[model samples]
Target: MMRRVRAKKFLGQHFLEDLGIARRITESLSIPPSHVVEVGPGMGVLTQFLVQREDLDLYLVEIDSESVEYLHQHYPQLSNRIIEGDFLKFDFNKIFPDKFSIIGNFPYNISSQIFFKVFDNRNHVDKVVGMVQREVGRRIASGPGSKEYGILSVLLQSYYTIEYLMTVDEHVFSPPPKVKSGVIRLVRNEVDKLPCDERLFVKVVKAAFQHRRKTMRNSLKYVEFDHGAIMHLPVFDLRPEQMSVEAFQELTKLIEEHPLCE
Candidate 1:
């Protein structure tokens, strides 16, 4: 028998009790999984569907001891698959020797952090299907010139082709979040390596977006590059919000080839 576990506010726990949504979320994983890891499987609402798939070597990582115990008690079939630890700090390389997909009704507070971890391990993580705050989903999948477009927009879109799958109603969760949720799918693109320095590309994108109101020429002035040469480029005339991922890549190359000092 399953036992009731209170959602911890500190952890931003909002259990998805709606089985229909759970089924949809699970079915969204189209990959023939060698391995899969579900983050924060609170109360096993989504786990119930994931464990049914014989193809996937499914694993659950939950932080709450009470919820972990409940999962073990209720879903004995999971057996040793349930890991009690922080998903952000867990060593995924040790778990899945090769590639794997990540899925979850992610904790809203740490959703961005979770994505940053995913970005760091993009080579091995081929696909990601997860729920996040609608605003975040829009921001990630937003394109150039959109007000929603910002840091996550350029960074994640640089390597992955993102799709905003659907909007989930707030009432579906046990303790419904104030904002509606959105499901998004991220598929890795064919670009193995970037045209410019990866570190410098990130720095440029972050610096460009720091002051959205300013033009790239003004916003990127402090980025340790040749202002005189960069100022001549037509791209500088555009605001950070107006620049595409490809445009940023080009800017990175410009900075690399034409350093004012050194």
Candidate 2:
């Protein structure tokens, strides 16, 4: 057996030990396979199965040096595919000139940031299959009106068709996390462009969700939009959590088109 790498607290490394779960996570990738990037592949549990898929050209990006070294010793077939760097800092376009999918057991500390990274590369990222804190997974897959829904729910749902896959118990990890883990997959939709100004759309969504408890009428004040006229609209009465992606899109347009331009 290869020497085990210690789970680093700072890196949020909870190495997944359940092989069945790993296989399930690996197989969750869609058919007609293409380029796949596995982030935070601690100890290569998932990599072991991902390597067998002849259809996929897989690359591993891990921030942990010890885990990376362990992967190097065990998965010699990986060769140059192992990247010793932060996935967030990586300019994936440099390594992946074309489209790709992402899959991994994402670190709890950086999972939200990771999705933001995914959102940045939505044009190239066709799908994402990640295991994260159960709460976060639910939040990503959640729809409007649910308490679990928030900023990420609204932003990511605007682009990807998110699905909550399954849950893994805390005990499944080598160093079990405090909470259960959930798997979620995001499949890109057919929306080439949205009806509203995309930049304003983000601003409106972020602003509204900043105070999720407040109505959009109150919360969106942070964005400095002239709410004088648009506040009369029925949507303003609803809280940020109550608004769907389409509702936010319309809200963005209303804000942009309002005559009170500063």
- Tens-place lDDT per residue, model 2, 152-182, is 9988998999999999999989799999999
| lDDT minimum window of 10 residues, candidate 2 | 221-230
Per residue, candidate 1 scores C-alpha lDDT tens digits across 1-262 of 6659999989989989889989999898888746889999989888888888987888999989999999999889887899998999989988788889999989898999999888889888888999999999999999998999998889899889999999999899889999999999998898888999999998998898889999988888898877876587788889988998998998899899888776
Q: Model 2: which residue pairs collide? A: none
Off by over 4 Å in 2: none
**Number of clashes in model 2?**
0
Which lDDT values do the candidates have, in the order given?
A: 0.89, 0.90
